[model samples]
Target: MARNIAFGRIQEDMNKTSFFKILADEDLSSESMRLIPNEFWRSSECKILPPKVTLKVAWGSSWPVNLSPFMGCYLMERKGWEEFLNDNHLGDNEFLTFTNEGNNCITVDIFQKNCVEILKPLNTSSSNVKNEEMSCVDPVIAESNKRKVDSNVYGASSSSSSAATFSLTIKKSHLTLLSIPVTFAKEHMPKVRTKFVIHDPKGKPWEVVYVPSNGSKLFSSGWRFLANGYGLAVGDLCTFRLVRPKEMVLEVLHDSP
Candidate 1:
């Protein structure tokens, strides 16, 4: 069944502004935050905000076990909720807390008006799912689909879209490879080299090398990828891919092993 992600509700007045785009604040908006329509929360926009509780750091696994502080926050939609609770509740500072009792912390931020939602089971569950997805190849494909690949290899006012096709190829039981196209310069250009670093779901690192080349080798040296896209960098993760293949081909493959 298709799932409908409802963001909750937004005041009618704020709903008309197109300035609101739901995304991680760090990636898209330099501004810490901006007001969003309550409907944005109802339509999957809720994820854009910080969780009410989060684990900043932790250690050990047992009793007296070294654990980080647990952080917490109280959320409010508007002045009314604050009046009811008798606290200065504004969706202003992105609040975060630490606890001596546990290995996690809490963060609280409001999503919309009149609603005080806690990101408990939902936050934990989603983090688990994201971790699992990151470990596998799924996230990479999703990233590629969502982000356009462009590079400034050529001296143009704008970057051109990569024309090469990308696909997953697995050889050994534990190895994965990503095939992508690379374009070469028309005139006698100096051979160059670049590198691509793939990151796993846990933010682990994997690196691959690509070398620039010309002639038949350029076409044959499809850049090899060692892992699926899930473990690789996405649109906002890193700035560029660097590699130079032995043969001059306008393509690079990311290989996983």
Candidate 2:
């Protein structure tokens, strides 16, 4: 069987933009959609406009649409763009990432929250505890020691290690399948596709796949089962610890209504 590469990147020639917020009234409705204000097209280095392109959603779906530079902003033309919005149920205040795939093909990823919420220290001492019994014994001391160990082993730049720990605020869609940011995954995970284990707060283990998102990959599998098994919901706060290259530990900081 062909190895299923988890994620891939768009061609370098494609024009890409940072994640941008969707205007409440303008982006979701039938009104014409405007590209986020940026030098993406305005920069002297980027002047060519592709007449036609495809829009691929990370979740799964693609649409062919026309592109036109209008009044210093790029506008998406054709009814297909509207249909894409409706199909995705995109609304105001959400976030979308756009990547032009050359040949008029653009890929998009939707984010329920405009920004990924940083994980705060649930408790300073027990913050890095990997064992339950030890954490319960002396959380303060355990946390202090963990910090020292992390400092010695992983150093100050947390990004340098294969392991990572962070928190995310759950969204409605996350209830079905949590979305891991490409930036986070790229930093802590192996480049190739693989299945990893997630240990919930209760110390139960579940298997999830780590798919890299170069440009085409969307939410693959493994996370939803974990979320549903734990009955996760929107507004909940989830803490994740990438314990090893293929193992993670999860904890629910707060459950949602």
Best by lDDT: 2
* TM-score, cand. 2: 0.36
- The 10 consecutive residues of candidate 2 with the worst lDDT sum are 1-10
The Cα local distance difference test for each model comes to 0.25, 0.50
Candidate 2 local lDDT, 1-257, one digit each (tens): 00011111222223343334343564354334555344544322435766655665432235666766666766677466665665555565555556543344444645444342112222335222222222111222222223322322222233233336767898887776567766766555656666776765433567676676576333358777887887777778876765444556677756634
TM-score of each: 0.19, 0.36
Residues 1-257 of candidate 1: C-alpha lDDT, one tens digit per residue: 00010121112123221122222344222222322233323322234443322221111101111211123222222332222112222233222221211112211222223232222221222212211111112222223322222232211211225322223243342233332334323222224443433323222334454445553212112123433433333221211222111111122233433
lDDT, candidate 2, residue 144? 28
Where in model 1 is the C-alpha error above 4 Å?
A: 1-165, 171-179, 183-191, 216-257
